[model samples]
Target: MKKIKLGNSGLEVGEISLGCMRISNLHKKDAGYVIENAMESGIDLFDHADIYGGGKSEEVFADAIDMSTSIREKMVLQTKCGIRDGFFDFSKEHILASVDGSLKRLHTDYIDILLLHRPDALVEPAEVAEAFTKLKASGKVRYFGVSNQNPMQIELLKKHLKEDLIVNQMQFSLMHTPMIDAGLNVNMQHDAAVVRDINTIEYARLNDMTVQAWSPFQYGMISGPFVGNEKFPNVNTKLQEIATKKGVTDSAIAIAWILRHPAKIQPIVGTMNPQRLTDIVKASDVELTRQEWYELYLAAGNELP
Candidate 1:
């Protein structure tokens, strides 16, 4: 369980954070076992969203943990809001209400961090800033951030925010290379030069905002995990080769690849299986070489111009 400072907040957290979206579906006993395993494996940060399982995930998580001050103080709890039924809302009223609901559901007096789930097209920066000011002053949340937002969107929010945005949770993996493609193919007439994310990777690094890589093993947004998927035989072969050489699972290699980036991105793994979670955590010990890292990248169907 390697640890790193989250952005410039100086909050030390596990390199591998646990994503709690799927935990709601597990039985109470099973969820407890999973959480216990994660803690034992050195995972200290837990990622959650208000809409995850319609808030049932937070309920199950609270039920699983003791929520005592002693136990709560040892873990970093981060959850998202602003996402509602089929829409996004960042109004001051919605943000304040969402944090209250999250606090009640998670049985916590204060959240380590609260993030706006996704960018709301109808966002009001002042309202969000007001909500954050009130939450911070009341000790409801210690830090703030955003998810799935580009650099400019974050800039807009930062304009009115008194607190520094510490994180930008984004979908990034070996198979998902849009964040890097534009940079690699800069000033070229290639498809990889599209600049889909508006140079989010560089922007985040420049701003000292930690980029949390969600779905580190998934290919497309909803295309599922690519570790052993038949659709990506090349990637699977390369992963297995490296895993065998490193004496780890292919999943560990995939996670290690993400950690190998210079940006110091934290990967949020969403596995609820105890054995799988333990295996994935091995990534904290594995560091890929330059050649091996690029091999895995090219095998994922990415090309260099």
Candidate 2:
């Protein structure tokens, strides 16, 4: 897998990383298979969240792999906080306690990257800054970021945060293109013209922040993956045609479409199936031409004004 510097953090990581949200459902040996396959495919970064499976995913990961200092030194562990049972918490107390829990579960000394899972309407920038400062000073987290946040929200945090937010995790894929849609529509008169994300991709690029695309294969928030779904036949057919021509799986073509963008967005694949992970990793080697990229876009029910 090819490596890219994560935002402005100066940390090099694989273009494709593994998301460990569902690992809690797998057996220890099976979880080992997933982590082993990911490492074999050159995926050095593993993404996690404090609330995923009630924080069991992180525990499963540490259980499946030898997280000794020597082994952990080679891989990057990134996890998110600020999410609770029924509410979001970015308070200094919550942030510190959450990191302690994650460190214990993941069997690690420090998190390679820590992201505020989501925006807390009641968030106090100073409190967040204090949490980050303490975390940095304690050597519990090396870098910081925010997820599902707008440019303005990020700027608000950046104003008080001494450390640069190196990454911004957002959901982007062939099916979910709202982030890209608003930009393409411009002043056109249509539903797509509504800017839902305030040009997040453009904002991240200008500020030197890396946009990490999560859920790269899903059709919608709860519509499940579109790879072979009968309802989205047009996009699936197009994906297959491109995959056949490129000698890779249709999922690989879908992932390649995201990687084709100039912003260098990273696609986090959450598949636990070893075979599927291998198929998705093939995306790193496939480069989609401009025409092919637009073809997949149009096939996915997007219109160009």
Candidate 3:
């Protein structure tokens, strides 16, 4: 597996990470299988969210893994907070409380990275900064970041934050390309030209914030993945075509497409099956040419200006 630094944070992580959302569905024994496979596959980063599986995912992870001091030193654990039972909360109290909950559940004294899961419309940057300051001072969190946030939101928080927001988690895939769409459609008259999220990917690149692409295989928010969905015939066909040439599964090709970007985006895949995790890790070995990268993008029904 290939390793890349998360911006200039000087923290090194695998090119591909394992998202632990669905692993919550696995039994303790089964979850152990997934964790073992992930380590063997060189996926040292395990991404989680407090709200995922009602926080059962983190609890299960702590319970399933060996958790020896030696093993714990080799793993990087990242989790997100801020979304509550109904509304989003980034208040100082909420942020502190959320990190405590995550640390308790993960059985770790410190979190490698903590992200605000989603932007809280009522966010007070000062309050968030206060929370971060306390957490960092207490040695509860070593790094900080944001998820599903635009450039302006990041700047607002960064203005008050002493810690560098080294990572931004956003949904991007061959199927979900809004982050890429706006940039390519600049100066065009198409619907794709309609700006959304203010092209946050470019901001991350400019600011030295690593972009972590979640749902790397999903079609979109509500709809399921496009792998076998008849609604997206072209993309599935193209994935298989490239997978055949590379001698890997179509899913690996899908992930390879995300890793092919110049931004060095890390694709967070949420596959629970042990063998599936192994296959996805192989994407680190598959390289896509520029032509092939755009081919998969267009195959997903995105139009260029």
Candidate 4:
């Protein structure tokens, strides 16, 4: 599999990463198969969040892998903190305790990367900085980042942070093209010109932060997958067309579309099916031409001004 540096952190990770949110419901045997297949398929980075299945995902992951140090050494484990019951928390206390919980559950000494799961409006950047400093000093976290944050929110955190924020996880896919739309429709009167993410994509590119695309196949948050959905017949048709031409699954075409961007986005796919995971990893080998890329974008019902 192709490897890319994760933003400016100088950490090399697989082009595609496995999102472990849904593993909480899998039997240990099934989870083991998924993990083994992902590693064998050349996926070395695994993404997790403390809120996933109320932390059961991490616990199950630990059980599946038996928390082997040798096995852990081979993979990059990234998890998020700051989200809590019914609200968000970024206080130094919460961050520190959350990391401790994650480490204990994941059966690891330190997290390769710790991201603030979401923007907490009441966040005190100083407290966050303190939390990160302590974590680093204690060898609990190697890198820091945020998820679902806009450029300004990131700037606010960076103001007090001593370490570079190397990643910003966001919901992005062929069907959800608002980030690309605003850029293409700059200064236009079209609806697509509405900027939602405050040019986060450009900010990450400018600041050398890697943008990790989550839900790469979904059209909207909580809105099921776009592939094979009758509501998105055109996109499904094009996905199939390209998948047939490339001799790969349509899922690979969807993932390849995300990886084709010049921004070098790392898509976090959450499929628990071992075969589906392997098929999705084929994206590393499939390169979409510029024309093909745009064709797929338009197939998702986007218009270029």
Candidate 5:
């Protein structure tokens, strides 16, 4: 697996990290098998969130890592907070309390990376800064980032916080690429939907913040799987065509399309099947040429002007 520096934090994480959301529901033996397979495949990063499986995900990870002492130092563990029932919370109390719970659940003294789950409408940057400071001072979290936040929202946090926010996790895939599409057709009024994210891909690179891709195969937000779904016949057809040419799985092509970008986005592969995790990690090795990359963009775009 390829490795990339996560922001300015100096922590190097695998280009493709394992997402642990589904592992909690799997049998304990099954969960252990999945994680162990990921490590053997050269994956050095794992992603988790507080709300995934109602905290069961962390427990499973805690057990899996505990089983292998040597592999623990080779992996990077990341998780999210700030998302509460019916709302978001970034206050000092919530941030502090959430980290404590995460540490306890993961059976670790510190996290490699910590992200704010989502944007809180009533966020107080000062309080968030305080929480980050406390965590850093006490060696609870080494790096910080945010999930599902826009450029302006991150800027707001930077204005009030002293810590370096290293990543912005967002929903991105070949089928749902408004962030990439919007920039390609900027200022084209006839195609109001053309402009999306307004160069968020560029913004992340400019700020030295790594972009983490979530729901990498979904057509939209929790809508449905687009991998082999007949609803997106054209998308799947195109995916297969490219996969055949690359000599890789259709799922690998789906992930490689994101890897082809210059922003260097890290995809969180949310696969619980051990074999599936191994298959997806090979995506890091699949390289798409400029022409092939644009082909995917055009196919995903509603209409090429």
Candidate 6:
């Protein structure tokens, strides 16, 4: 298992981390099995969220982890907060209370990384900074980051934040490449084609923040993944060709596409199947050539200018 330094924290984490959202209430037994397999395969970073299953996800994680001192010591557990009942909260009170709840549910003393789940429209940067400062001082959270946040939002927090923001979790994949696509389609007539984030990939890279790619295989927003789906024949066809050439499964090809970027993004894979997990890990080894990368992008409906 290859490890990369997480942002500027100097903490090295596995290249491929396990997304534990689907592990909790959705598939209890499968989640446990996948976690055990991740350990066996040397995956050390476990990702979670407070609202993944209405706090039930963390509860099950506590049960699944089940008091294994040795295992806990070797792994880095990360979770996100701020997303509440159809709203976002980044208040000092909420942040503090949320971390306490997460600690109790995960059955751990301190979280390795805590992310503001999303950008709260009504966030007070100073309040968030205070909460993070207190948490670090008291040993509740080791590091902090944000999810689905633009550069401006992160900059606001950074202004008041004492701890260095380490990671930014976002929706990124080969098929749904808006971060890449918008730039390619910039100045087009359509509003949807306009560039968003103003180059978030470049922003994170320049700011020394790690980009965590969630839903790494999805075809688009809220749509199912494109793997083996006839709806995206071109996407699957290209994936098949690349997989055949690399002698790896198509899932690994999809992962390799994201890993090939210069941003050093970490993929949070959501598969519970051990074989699928193993296959995705193979992406770390299969280096996609520049031509192969462009070919796959073209197949996904993005025309090169």
Among residues 3 or more apart in sequence or in different chains, the pairs in candidate 3 whose N, CA or C atoms overlap within 3 Å are: none
Per-candidate TM vs. native?
Answer: 0.99, 0.99, 0.98, 0.99, 0.95, 0.95
List pairs with backbone clashes in candidate 6: none
**Clashing residue pairs found in predicted model 1:** none
Score candidate 4 by lDDT.
0.93
Per-residue error (Å), model 6, residue 260: 0.4
What is the alpha-carbon lDDT of model 6 when measured against the actual structure?
Answer: 0.87
Clashing pairs in 4: none
Q: How far is 209's C-alpha from truth in model 5 (Å)?
A: 0.6
Give the per-residue lDDT of model 1 (tens digit) for 154-225: 999999999999999999999988898888898999898999999888998899999999999888874788
Give RMSD to native, each candidate: 0.7, 0.7, 0.9, 0.8, 1.5, 1.6
lDDT by residue (77-123, candidate 6, tens digit) is 99999988878899999999999999999888999999999899999
Evaluate model 4: give its TM-score: 0.99
Which model is ahead, 3 or 4, in terms of lDDT? 4
Off by over 4 Å in 3: none
Output the better candidate (5/6) by lDDT. 6
TM-score of 3: 0.98
Single out the weakest 10-residue window by summed lDDT for candidate 5.
190-199
TM-score of 2: 0.99
Off by over 4 Å in 1: none
- Give candidate 6 misplaced runs (Cα > 4 Å): 26-29, 185-193
TM-score of model 6 vs. true structure:
0.95
